[model samples]
Target: MRREIGKRILINSPENENAIEVHNLHKSFRLPTERSWGLKQAIFNRLRGIKGYKDQKVLKGLNFTVKQGEFLGIVGRNGSGKSTLLKILAGIYYPEKDSTIIVNGNLVPFIELGVGFNPELTGRENVYLNGALLGFSNKEMDEMYDDIWKFAELEKFQDQKLKNYSSGMLVRLAFSIAIRAKGDILVLDEVLAVGDAAFQQKCNNYFASLKEKKQTIILVTHSMENVRRFCDRAIMIEDGKIAAEGDPSEVAEKYMSLFK
Candidate 1:
């Protein structure tokens, strides 16, 4: 089934080629037993001989195309599958059932803080580790090491164990490493929310520079202000589907309306 979906994606390619194309994407996860009403219900289901539980569909038939050098922002409330969509695009998770994801160029995803870090390792060791995870060689990390540290502002704590570092510090280091990797597609998921206000401003400026350099970025953020400032176009996902897609300002306004 996955092979057939891949074939369909290949056949639907645009003539000009896009940075990323998704067709009929769907993702779901099995609900845990604890999520059910109680142990009695779990026992009842077990006694009923139900082995496979119903899964919660996180994404449903989502389709979108991102052009080269486009800055796209994905906005949604909690559990609206915004992060799932970005993860699918980043090749972190394969969609369930019939779905297609075609992406061109290298992808750098900063989806979660401390995602690739080792708590037992020193910050310096983790720097090289994370760099390698991002497809950077030792020589490349050696060349970019100082710059990464400077950007992360963790020079003094470089030798400290990552477990000893604060969450903000971890995020700063991860963000610095990700941005320095210089991938063609950057998937940022609420990364700017981790650090201090001043650092957030710096990160914003860095994104601005990336935009000027024509890097394709897909940002999943709940911050409407950031969406309005950084993205040329924005999309809102509701119930695992595209609710709106258009100008950043207009889409953001409409997204906020749902809360009201």
Candidate 2:
């Protein structure tokens, strides 16, 4: 009887549940021209023309699913909604119309580098600020502070104001802190291009470690090499919609073909 029940369960098994599910997602932006402060200019411009302002459709009915432990790369040209999609997934932007984004895990987004950092604040202060934004308590940040500073190699300049630091330094500090914040899902834009070669190598090593741990990663980049090396699967977005989705190499090839 047990064997028969097991067989029946196997037969009725459902498809694997995905870690991230996006169904019919849509987003748009309205570019409205404000009325001029001067009444004469506003009246003149309105009388002359301006029939209808156009709304830009940034994302249109996008649908895809990402499974646990999958490294998914998004490849697209500029203005193709790559950043927008990442933002939506990161909960930074709401879709314009009817849409659903179901994410079933902790998420860490390395989208805006040094965004929460205040120029007047010291590096140490900024570190705490960014940590809090990432949902790390002060005690947790204190526990990881030494490691973060070591990885960022900014111990010497920790007391220095952020405005005094170079762009490379800022990127290093921000990237290090963001990566150390634990999350089941990691989202990265093209921020890897900001650092020098040595730092880039370190980032690659870090990503390799994450891959070994089977962390789910969604990376948006134009570098085909990164897509081929880091991603198990790739998706190409064209004109706010999915154009192709499959093996990283194959999708990359198809994406490149569009330019030719």
Candidate 3:
């Protein structure tokens, strides 16, 4: 699918120019209904021509391409499939047949904070575990351990079990690890701030630094302010389809119009 992104022609852009591309993407979920629970009930429902489940269509055929060094924001309201779409791009979920997702570089997605975190493990142990999940060797994790500890400001709490840490403490540790384990393309699902006021400020600054580095980013967020402030382009999704796309400011304005 070809579309004009500002003055550039997306389809004609060189492969190296695009950090990511998605085409003809579709997704749906089969939600269980009453008769789906019991074997006998399911059989009876099937006999009566009932599928015993409701198909929840989440994403329609979506198409877009993210150029290298572009900070693209994905904006949507609740239940609009924003997170679902991100997961599909992160390879956590798959779309239907004929869907195409192409990535030009290594992708690191911070879609869920601390997805593999173990509450029973000590803060230090969890760091290694999470790093391994990110495909880092223990040796590599060891090399970066001190910096992670220092960035999180949880050096003193390293010995403590994660369950004992405050919510803010957990966010600090997780966010610290995510940024340290960098990749060619970064996908963030939220505002990247969920802790104390000071730490939130640090998070903002970190994002600013990333912007200065010309990092390619795909951010899925509800914050229009961030869309306008950080994104060169933004796309708004509604009912599992692209509702609007292009300049972040214009997209943000279209998104706001729905509520007015």
Candidate 4:
């Protein structure tokens, strides 16, 4: 079965008021059916009139809009399509036919934070590598190099190989670099917490600053506290559909009621 892909366009017009707009969005994945592993099994299943795969709908007919500088939070239970929706907005996945997504300006997806990091490289070397991936020139990276290490609190380990750093240290470094990204919209997926308690507090404060500055952000998080604290508006997805939307507190309460 062939799946049709929808359109996603990016336009950088200052006159455009919305940072993101989605309409009738849908996404589905074909999962192999039981006992349909290899070519032989697939041919046998086809001969037996078995489709050999099941369609799993992750998002269905979602409609929403995010105004410029609005902080929108998406919340849902496991497998409820929150990540799928974010991936679509981030251009990592295409939506079904008839679905439409419009991004008004450059979008930086935090989901791609550690994409270009090389474990064999030193922390400083990896920083430059990752910065290049984020569109920073060598001189630009040098200008902010010290600040990046200071924020990640990994200055002492600058010359240390990334392979030698702890898991938490890697996350901190990636996160520090990611925040320096310049874009009109930021899409984040559960990346608010990194490192120890003190570091988390620092991250929290940084988010607060972004919020104070009215930066456009699309956050997908399981933390209700974060939703209430940072989100100007929120949406909760349930079973591949929008279950609730509007005020952050109200949506958070609706999301919490799911367990009850």
TM per candidate comes to: 0.86, 0.86, 0.90, 0.93
What is the C-alpha lDDT profile of model 2 across 109-140, one tens digit per residue?
A: 87877768999999999999999988899999
Which rank order by lDDT, best down to worst?
4, 3, 2, 1
| Model 3 worst lDDT run, 10 consecutive residues | 1-10
Residue-wise lDDT of candidate 1 within 1-260, one digit each (tens)?
A: 02222312323333545888888888887666555677787778778877435678899888899888899999999999998888777766767666877777777787775567999999999999988888899999999999999998989999999999988889899988887767777888888686899888888899899889989899999899989998989989999999999999999999889989
User: Could you give candidate 3's per-residue lDDT for residues 1-260 as a string of tens digits?
Assistant: 13222111123334588888888888887788883488898889879988788878898889999989899999988999999989888888766666778877788888877769999999988999899888789888989999999988989999899999998889889988888767778999994647888887888888889899999999998888888988999999999999999999999999999899
Deviation from native of the Cα of residue 170 in model 2, angstroms: 0.9
**Candidate 2: C-alpha RMSD after superposition:** 9.6
lDDT of 2 at 35: 48
C-alpha lDDT values of all predictions? 0.83, 0.84, 0.85, 0.91
Best by TM-score: 4
Give the clashing residue pairs of candidate 2, or none: none
> Each candidate: how many clashes?
0, 0, 0, 0
Estimate the lDDT of model 3: 0.85
Question: In model 4, which residue pairs have backbone atoms overlapping below 3 Å?
Answer: none
Q: In candidate 2, what residue range of length 10 has the lowest lDDT sum?
A: 1-10
Clashes of 1: 0
Please list the residue runs of candidate 3 whose C-alpha ends up more than 4 Å from where it truly belongs after superposition: 1-15, 35-48
lDDT of 4 by residue, 1-260 (tens): 56679999889997989999999999999898775399898878879999888989889899999999999999999999988999999888988899999999999887756777898999988999999888899999999999999999889999999999999999999999988988889899999866889889988998999989989999999999999999999999999999999999999999889999
